[model samples]
Target: MEVMEIIKDAFVFPSKDMKTLLIYVLLSLVAAGFSFFGTVVYVLGFVNPECFMWGGMAVIISLLIGWVMYGYLISVIKSGIEQSDEVPGFEWWENFITGFNNFIVTIVYFVIPAFITVIVGYMTNVYGNAMIVAQEIYLQATYSYMGSSSAIAFDAIYQALVNLLFSLTITITVAVVVFVIFSFLQTMAEARLANTGSLSEALNVFEAAKDIRRIGIGKVIILVLLVIIIVAVIEMIFSALFSIIPILSILSIIIAPYLAFFAQRAVGLLYSDIA
Candidate 1:
């Protein structure tokens, strides 16, 4: 199938069956609710420290929900590669373990860019700037929760790092480019893993690259570019739209997992030639 067709099909697939789409959206809402509960508890803990324990449990539950969602997405991709119209059903433990393995595979791919980001951060003292921003955010949160102003200690020192802003921007840009480049392999690896049901295939970069060769490098690159472009465009649109109608911003939350469905479907279709 052509890359454009694949993308179109992937984007439209989730909405092809309204019931399935609603189920996915309901799952997203459950995750969001638990996450919201955790946030509220953490903030309340600022007043009553005992609330922290419940906040921790809420966070754990939210993470578990996210993990299960990832497992189902793997199934979505599996269905896509098989060119099947059927929605894959959840297999509880199977989904959790597969999602965990996929998480490990993703972290493995992120190492190089993350290492470079760390090195650049250390050299430029960008981490100092990050710490300053974090402290400022914390102070604001404390003020909001406690109704008392908190000290902003590092603003003056942080301003000195304005000179490093260029270096920080370059670092982020380089990391994104490198990430996108590796994503081609990662996408291939993931599709193979989904197809073979083996974590080993996801780690086999050499084999993943071989699969890309079979799929055609030009086609793969275009697929990656298309996904990136669409994602960026939609992000911009949502940012602006949500800013205009802040209450409707909740729609973006619902849309997020559906976007994941679209991407994984494309990943499957992109590798469909070989799968």
Candidate 2:
């Protein structure tokens, strides 16, 4: 199918296959569990230096869990697609098959894309830093003549501006790199699913991948906005509760990370449908 037509068809389905989608989400959660645990452990180490060892353990555990979860997720999606006429299929070994496919795909899809992205990101950062430094030099030179009284103020202002510019540049640079990488992966995933294995076949999928992002970004944009809004509101409400109730405050602290993880995984599943 043509790119637009594939999108139209995908949207027509509109994730009516909830069972399959839910299975995918569950698998994602399973994979995410370890990462979350590791993060929490690492954070806690700030309060207790000795906990660093525990954090290290958490990191190792998380990787193992994430790998297993990813494997299962791949199997579920593959099986569900292959047997679309029936109800969704869920299996444990699908993870292994997915892992194998990923092993091949890593070399095929990820390594080169990642390398190019890193190179592009490095160049962008260098350009951005150069601009910041030049702007700082211009400001410092302009201010040095303005008497010593304002020199300190100008120096502070210059520093702040340079920092902000550097931060903004890094953020935009990273975002573009990520978007490009995601676009590459989206096309590759669809191509893999569609069984377009040859290099020529895969390159053709890039056309569809770009189209998918162009057409489908809007579909899930609202979901992202909603999640951000809701999370902010939830955190605010919880913050208020901490002032009024001590016990629930602690619970909220513990629960917030999981809530964030859940929100991210939920959003991830929606995007995976198109990918």
Candidate 3:
């Protein structure tokens, strides 16, 4: 299938089974809503330490919902890839297991990148904090020699900022590359798992990488970029329209699943063609 055809089908395919799609939407809404709530709780906790307990509970519940939803969506995408006639609906135990497995795949795939990011972040924090303390001490010690030490203080601050920015840039760059690579692998793996019902196959990095090459890495990258652009545009439009009416923003919970499914279906269709 051509990329355009895949994209077109993504938008049109769900209508063929609107009832099932709606059911998926409802489930998606619950998952997304809770996830959003959890994030809000976390932010609140960050702003006010007293909310930490509530935030922790919310985050845990949200993670559970998000995982189940992720698995269910993969099931939906798999159905699309196989050109199955029936749309998938809620299968609680099945979805949870699949979701958990998918989560594991993601964590395992990104562990190295995540570890690097954490280490870099921690180092940046420590270095930045040390710089602040040193600057303070420098100012205290040089109170009588302020004129001579001003340059030293300025240089110290500039170096600290430069180091922080450089570390952040490297961290972000590495993260983005890792994310794109794993995203390609995961898409193929999920589609395969969905098609073959084998967790082992889904987790097979070598096989997934081979499929990515077969599918044409360039094409996959292009398709992913296109999907991201389309989704971003849709989100911007949705946000603009919905922001005017606070209550209407709730509709995104329902709409987001459809958009997500559409993207997944697009990739699934593309995978089906290449496979």
Candidate 4:
């Protein structure tokens, strides 16, 4: 139940069956390969529009594979919630459905934050320009009143630029805060969805809040921080080790599923205490 123990157990959970882990890695490779293929086609398609269709197909295939990967992560969380010691077996259709459910849950959770971010962005990029126009107008009036031709109004332009910079800084800060808060909530929501097999259950903010309360906000934060730190360190190691061999470097993608599995398992373990 301790945060550290949960993290350690989560890390170990992925490797409990190397065969299952390899399946995850192989799926990741397929997804990555298709994604890469799509990118290349898109780039080449810029010169030959006919190639775009192939790129589109690649993208669609990649998305399906990615959905499977995501769904499997949900299963990991479910397994953790159930306190199951064994790895989950793959059910392709079920995984796809779960993955789609997760996508819907994710969109519902973040829609408001995304909308707010867009509004702030519009205000900063569009309405924020009004200040510059007002500044220019003020400068023109001042020049006319002085009985002289209007100049570039360098000082006014400078002040407007400074105001835009200030607005930009504020916008970025708000976006960051919104993303973090919603992302935290979404994580809890995903765990709930995984355990209950109900989309509505996951979307119930009040229910998720109850779980958070039961789990202790401090413990959740600690779990998140530890997982992030561990993933970062592991990623760095993978990058270093893989870079040693150019062709073998692509093997680093294998770690992606491992890290994802570990993190979700941690979330599941956190819920097991209450769920």
Query: Whose TM-score is greatest here?
Result: 4
TM-score: the better of candidates 3 and 4: 4
lDDT of 3 by residue, 93-134 (tens): 888888888887777667756776677667657466556757
Off by over 4 Å in 3: 29-65, 118-148, 244-250
Superposition-based RMSD of candidate 1 using all C-alpha atoms, in angstroms: 8.2
Candidate 1, residue 97: CA error in Å?
1.9
Candidate 4 Cα deviation (angstroms), residue 89: 1.2
Query: What is the per-residue lDDT of model 4 for residues 78-140, given as tens digits with 9 covering 90 to 100?
Result: 999998999898889999989888989888888968888889978777356656767676877
Candidate 4 — what's its lDDT? 0.85
Model 4's TM-score against the true structure? 0.85
Residue 132 of candidate 1: its Cα lDDT?
69
lDDT of 1: 0.81
Any runs in candidate 1 off by more than 4 Å, and if so which? 119-174, 234-254
Taking all chains together, each candidate's TM-score versus the true structure is 0.74, 0.44, 0.75, 0.85
* Colliding residue pairs in candidate 1: none
Among the numbered candidates, top lDDT falls to 4
The window of 10 residues in a row where model 1 has the poorest summed lDDT is: 149-158
Would you list the C-alpha lDDT of every candidate in the order shown?
0.81, 0.52, 0.76, 0.85
On lDDT, the stronger of 2 and 4 is 4
Candidates arranged by TM-score, highest first: 4, 3, 1, 2
